[model samples]
Target: MEDSNGSGRGPTVQDVAARAGVSISAVSRAFTPGASISKKTKERVFDAANALGYTPNLVARSLATHRSGIVGLVMGDIRNPYYPEVVDALSRRLATHGFRTMLTTVWGDITVDDVAPSLVQSRVDGAIIASIADADRLGELLYKNGAAVMLFNRSAATSDKLSSVRCENVEGGRSVANYLLDKGFSRLAYIAGVEHIYTTQEREAGFVGRLMERGVQLFAREHGDYTYKGGFDAALRLATADTRPEAIFCANDITAIGAIDGVRAAGLRVPEDISIVGFDDIELASWPPYGLTTVRQDKAALIESCVDVLVEQIRSGQRTRHIQLVPVSIVERTSVR
Candidate 1:
């Protein structure tokens, strides 16, 4: 019940090591999974630890090994349902690999700079950034702080120093354009997310670029900022215009659902009056009310790639850059004619 120093304090690693007839480092290795130690030594350490009721201090062990066994997950705008699903899958995957998740949300007035210091101070072995306005700055900061950086659902265009896992956004956009054009819709409109973000730019470029190649022009364009209210407002604007588009392609599913409501509120029938399409086939997209046709990104593949890249960097102490682009597919539903 007492430490090696015999000051009446609870048992410490020193007490366990002394009783086990081993060095302090040996005791640490016994507790660390995958550490190099023989079974007999580990059994002795466990028996001594049990007799003395000693438990290794994780914080102290982290200081010695320089591994916090934690991964920071920086997300943006949890209001969108897509991110919650990403969080769930990513957390479970990381747990299976013996690492815990430390979450931080950057939305509204909150910026990455505001949260980066805490994540760095916690000594996270690595970080996975789901969304960020300034990826370059955040990647640099985390990299300098000794944390391997991985961008989830983001491209490495802005920050080549970090690894990334994302879907083929440009191709997804092209597929949407092809679907709408194949339906014989001459007048097509587009709803965009943030103007400067890579995802938005790539999706818009692919959609409009394909349309131009087909000798057609975009009838209208609006910024939805990847939010429900933004989508609603943009749709209302398009609905009341002197000339309305026969079809609308939203950058994401949340926006598409909002656009559908706006179209209905404006007394127009979906598919019958104006066909709609969306990207990122979120769970809500398949609902009877929405039935949104969109591009489906493989969430499982993306999370697996992110975890693999980050864990390798942490274990190897090497900063090897990896940029993975998972394929995307079009999901047809009642929203599209």
Candidate 2:
């Protein structure tokens, strides 16, 4: 047997075959999904591959089978508690189905055109993008390029011209608005997250629409970059207004937490002087400090559905081009009456 590059060159498939005393085709069959290889040979190949650090080349497999077992997760910042939970749920679910997750945070710096090349290089079998409807063309190109694509939380135009998984943003907005009104908050303000994102826009529209139904109006509105500090600074502005709002609604939990700081530092009591509400009942929302009354997006179900749809697309080579809207609910807590 010829030893090639003991000086830092990693073991290859050939090395694994030689170590296991098997033909090259037998080693390939052992690793390749659905390929016919005897159990004993499979075990031997696996043992050799493990010993030699000979991980299967996913790209090479894609070239042969035309199916990559990798999924690309294109999303925004993972700093938000909601996304990390979604990612964790999706990653585990995908793993159970023999798919791996590759994460990418656009961070609003790169364009849609820049996304596909990286995903293509990684040879992701599918992609799940959490973004607004502005990237319809980009999404279309991805689907056209052979990767299954799904949009989470945010809606995107599909190959079928409908959204995939459209959450009840409007309903959530009404729920928050009614909760505040029921608690008798007359003066109101909204701390929005990342002006262009779909969630913020939807929640704002829904909340404002419902508030108008009660003949109430938003006294002020400020932008937060879906961040804690963004909410903190925006909260200060709202609280210090000439006729400050008696109630403030943030788009997400992080902003709500920051708003809490903003409200307290201004010498106002929570639920007494100023009531607050938020969306996405993240883990932090239930903490003793926040106890935030917010909308629940059913993170587990959403992630499961996302993975389910993508896996089916990959397996069948067909699009499950359907928009699934999971329901949202309002959870009452100390922040609201």
Candidate 3:
């Protein structure tokens, strides 16, 4: 195969073996981590490899072992700050366990089922998806293809057939409602992420449901499309409306920042003119400019649970059907009254 430098080819394992005065199997053992090779032989193999620019072909090794040592990570909404953390943690943790991550982007219009056919050919031991348009159909497809799968940050409604790791979004939202109401926020508004997003739906239900029990109606609602600019525009419209909301609950931290900016642009003081609360306590939420009050989803717990589920399914060659929920807590800052 032609290399990036447009060379015909590069050094092979056999060349290293010959230069090191060792057999091919010896060279292989030296390269394999935790393989039973003498220190001297390993040093010799490395010296020869460095001199000849020979690197082991992982694809060929996987072919011989019947294990790809790779995991597919499919996700959308790359713009969200939360997702980049997810990707980085998964890649780092998986590497320590000797697995590589193959990231695949799924468009909003595409479902997991549409991508399954291609995944089957890639021969990945397992996959972890951040979201799915049709969970029930994709669950069946993965089962049929004999691939173990885990869903993250969302759960399937069709059945409890899929494994998942997510935060307690509903309870988190309810807690926000309780906190805001206790602080005497009578005219509350909601800044939604997306109409159909599972987390947003669950959170909205919890927040609105709590208000209903208190005999207080929601003052306003706006859809932010789970984006910063969406929140900015939505906040502007809400601020200019006839009945301005006293408090606003944002779906995520980025949106909250945008809303804060919007409120400022409209010459409104935070917590004085309009108190704001947001979910997902991203790094920027605590910045001096925003200092957003938010609910914190435990990123460390979520990432660990996902890795555990995927690894168990891959190593056991069986589905555990485990569902893990990481708890969320409110982090109070200056954004709220």
Candidate 4:
């Protein structure tokens, strides 16, 4: 073996030991977190490591610890304000528990197989998928590969097969529907997110089902993809219909803002010509430009629970499967009467 300098030797633990004036075990301990070594010895070892440009190999660490100390975070549709907040919270909380986050955004025709395969290649200790509605099949691959897996804001249809943390989307939708109807919104419309998302489907089902029971017909239903443009376009369609709805329930705050603009462009005053209610009370929802009335998902508690479950699975070498439902509450603001 040849070193980078063409010396007739490859760098070894002995080389680091000699340079640091320490035993080989001391050098190893310095590089390994939670391993015991004197501070002075650790500093010397690190300095030698820097001089040699030698990166600690995690493969060896994994062999010794039976852990990778890395967490894969799979998120979709980052354009939605709600997701970024979720990602931030998840990453921060995971870091506190000594786990690093590997972020992957599945967008623009990306498949489930593509995402899990890539993360597996990187040898992430475990994975937390935040928004894959069709995650049942993907869960199989990760489990087979011995990767601890957890779902966030999404659930597997296969009972007790996967772990997940999500909000009470149905309750939120029902609350919004009842609130709007009680405000005397006789005619209502729904601006739904992607039809395939489990959370969106549940919210839509609850909102529309509750309204129908009250004999309040939904004048229109359109898909928003949880985006501003999708909501804007859907808004125009809802407003142009004969005998338009008196209020609109958007799937998320970003869409709600766009819907408000779309309604105003068509010469309608919010809550006068139409009232608007949205889910996912993102930060921007309370901004001056759009004081949107929305449903708040408990971001902190959701993220904490997700990280805790993932760590348990990772450390125990087994799945700690549980279904956690975080509560959601409505935030009333100027967008609705």
**Best candidate according to lDDT:** 1
Ranking by lDDT: 1, 3, 4, 2
List, residue by residue over 142-260, the lDDT tens digit for candidate 4: 77788888888878877466788889999898899899989877778899888777888899988988888888777788899889998888888788778788899999889999999
lDDT of each: 0.88, 0.80, 0.83, 0.82
User: Please, what is the TM-score per model?
Assistant: 0.88, 0.84, 0.85, 0.85
Considering TM-score, which of the candidate structures 2 and 4 is the better prediction for this target? 4
Better of 2 and 3 by lDDT: 3
Choose 1 or 3, whichever is better by lDDT.
Answer: 1
- Poorest 10 consecutive residues by lDDT, candidate 1: 1-10
Residue 161 lDDT (model 4): 65
List ranges where model 3 is wrong by over 4 Å.
Answer: 1-54, 108-114
Instruction: Compose the digit string of candidate 3's lDDT tens values, residues 1-337.
Output: 6742345678778778888999999998876543678889989999999987787888888688666777888877778887888899998988766678888776677666567777777777777878546655665566567767788888877766678889999998899999999998899999998776788899999899999988889899999987899888888888888889989999888888899998888888887889899998888899998999999999899989888778878777788688888999999999997
Candidate 2 Cα misplacement greater than 4 A, ranges: 1-54, 132-134, 157-163
lDDT string for model 1 (243-308, tens) is 999999999999999999989889988989888899898999999998998899998899898998
Greater-TM-score candidate between 1 and 3: 1
For model 1, the stretches where C-alpha displacement exceeds 4 angstroms are: 1-56
